[model samples]
Target chain A: MIENAKVCLYPKNPGEVVRILEQEGRRALILAGGTTASQVRDPGVTTLVDITRMAPPTDALTHEDGEWFLGCNLRIQQLAAHAGLKQVFCGMLCDAALSVGSRPIRNAVTLGGNAVSVFRWSDPPVALLAMDASFDLVGPERERTLTADRFYSRHPRRILKPAEILKRIRVGVPSGRHGGAFFKFARTAFDLAVVDVAVCLWFDSDICSRARVAIGATRNVPWLSTRAARMLVGKRLEGKSIRAAARAAREETKTADDIRTGREYREQMVEVIVRRTIERAGDNALGV
Target chain B: MDIHVNINGQAVAWRANPGENLLDVLRREGFASVKRGCNQGDCGACTILVDGTAQRACLLLAGQAEGRSLVTVEALGTPAEPHVLQQAVVEHGAVQCGFCTPGMLLSAKALLDENPSPTYADVCAALDGNLCRCTGYKKIIEAVLDASGRLRK
Candidate 1:
């Protein structure tokens, strides 16, 4: 409830959005999907800039030159239902999108919202980081691109300027044998994840050439387990290597006690989910 | 602010506060079927169809409803001739407290409209957002399946 909002502007394009944000400064809020915006109680917010109308009307997902571009304004459900993405990365993105809230919530929640809000329980960031996606940001100064690593390095809000907007996400579709899997452990299907894991692997023949292991809901922000990923590279996707990688992920992650679970329990589950996700990703890569 | 929307096949213009949510505005305009349950999005009590897609009204600002088609449970059926889903719920004893019925019906309608022949898993997934505190989900699931069959026939 943006209590002090006295004006809601429906911007027709990015230029208009930037203009409004620049003019209103701290008093303006960007409303995308409104899932997060509806909960705003900030008394300082006096203007709402609605961006739904400015989103790309069609072809939410486009592929060109081996890179996939995802419109930020696309709904989570749309991403879940996208046939192109369903086939990409062994449908890991679809799984993450489907794992978001329920059907109604997914219908209203946008991909940009999920990415920008940066909640520990947010599902897409974990997968996006694992996939090494990049973001195209539009601002009053000039457009800039940031890798998922850099984008999620700090709170996105802190990184983004007042008038900047996340416009599109780009990921290179791996051409060779590659697969990814995302798993979220929650009390219920619709509950916020207690611990979530996403693993993406590229295999050179029977050997793992590259790997990415990302975990969320355990830290302030979802982060890539580089040590765990390093453990998988140059090793065969076998029991010994998988366990070692999972152990690294467990050790690298620092969990805290929350209302949902304890720190030790989360640490234990991280290892389990990481191992299983890696196995699933291996099977996906092999088409087994 | 003035926001215009097509509600239940009628185009109407209404005054809305910039901060007001669609749920409050809809109910204020006499759309009593749109319940104000959790105020938060967890409870699907304020579920409505925005552009034929089921969305929680509480999550949408009233200004965002402009230039969109909105549907409420009121458009589904009348007491004289209830919608097939409504009729099936009553016959299958799915209505207990009936507090979650409207939301359940709307969610079910959205599913059946898209998938005329849905399996048990599909119905379960569709109603996952709407919680039936009366613990009558089994009957409700049964009713949705039955209604899908009836609608197809």
Candidate 2:
């Protein structure tokens, strides 16, 4: 229960939001999408500033050559409906958006707020990390864009400051024959991932040319299996290499025990999900 | 302090206190359709459309809803003249114990509004957040599809 809380509805403007926060100082909690209740674990959160009514970006999704610019308010559901965005990210947004809690949660949920929360049991961070996505973060200082990968490194421990606004996320369309799939396994179907695996596999015929697999819900931040990915880099999509990579992934998993599952078991499940997701991805890549 | 919000289409002032969620505030103001099931966002029982998008009112502060158009279960058609989605559910015999019906209907409405022609998977995705213990929810899925077809014209 919140105490001495106040609900302040400032108009939807970036400068206004910043100004209000600056004025309120530590008393204000900028609530966007209302989806952060699951993400934020603050007991002292009493006052809320609804940032939902903020005006949409006064711009279009300008595609200069190949690169496209998506606004912060460009919701994941809208992104799924968009024909252009569907083909580029290879159904990552649709997959991520569908699995986030429920329909009502997704409806109000924004793409920007997800990254800002920086929870392990999130989908966008893993999906964005896989597709080389970056965010156009607007803060009190100025506007700057940082790679989502860099964003993860910057805040390896916890979330970034509230003043730093996660403006817009930019995802580069995948080039060449890249096959990817994200499979998350949890105790309850809707619960947080016991172990979530996202595999982006590049293939040269049946053999893997390159692969970037990022696993979340296992550690503080996402655990990128660089060693495991290296094991499968040049090897044929056959028996020994797959098991070896799975082993390395299991060994690397530092999943702490929680109410849902044990650490040792979660580590084993990571191997199982990694093997299965990679196998499915490999099959799709091989057209088998 | 009081907040000005547009509930459904009409603008109304909500005397929301601190710690009062939009769901509770709506109930206090005599809009009792917004069910308080789990208090957590996991249950879709407290679902409503904030700015035409389905969201868990339980999680949203009344302040966040200020200035935005909110569509509770009341916003949809009534028993005498039900909305298309409501009519579809009735026609399909989708109401069982009917605890999750309001949320389910709102979820369907949000889905149909967002995507007029969603596939079967889209319908399932729309109902992901809502849980009905008594009913199997298969009929609800059919009802949403039926509503989608009816709304297509």
Best by TM-score, which number? Answer: 1
For candidate 1, the per-residue lDDT at A125 reads 89
lDDT of 2 at A130: 64
Calculate the i-RMS of every candidate, to one decimal place: 1.0, 2.5
Candidate 2 regions with alpha-carbon error over 4 angstroms:
A7-12, A38-47, A55-63, A154-162, A203-209, A283-288, B87-92, B114-122, B145-153
Which has the greatest DockQ?
1
Please give the distance, in angstroms, between residue A227's alpha carbon in candidate 1 and its true position after superposition: 0.8
> How do the residues A1-288 of candidate 1 rate in per-residue lDDT, one tens digit apiece?
777788789987887888888899999888888989898889998888888888454227898998888888889999988898888898898999999998999999999988999798999889999999999999999999999999999989988988998988998888888989999999887899999999999989988999999999998789999999999999889899999999999999898999999999999999999999999999999888
Number of backbone collisions per candidate = 0, 2
**Residue A205 error, candidate 2, Å:** 7.2
Native contacts recovered by model 1: 0.73
- Find the 10 residues in a row with the least total lDDT in model 1 chain B: B128-137
Computed on alpha carbons, the lDDT of every model, listed in order, comes to 0.90, 0.74
- CA displacement after TM-score superposition, residue A1 of candidate 2 (Å): 5.5
Candidate 1 CAPRI category? medium
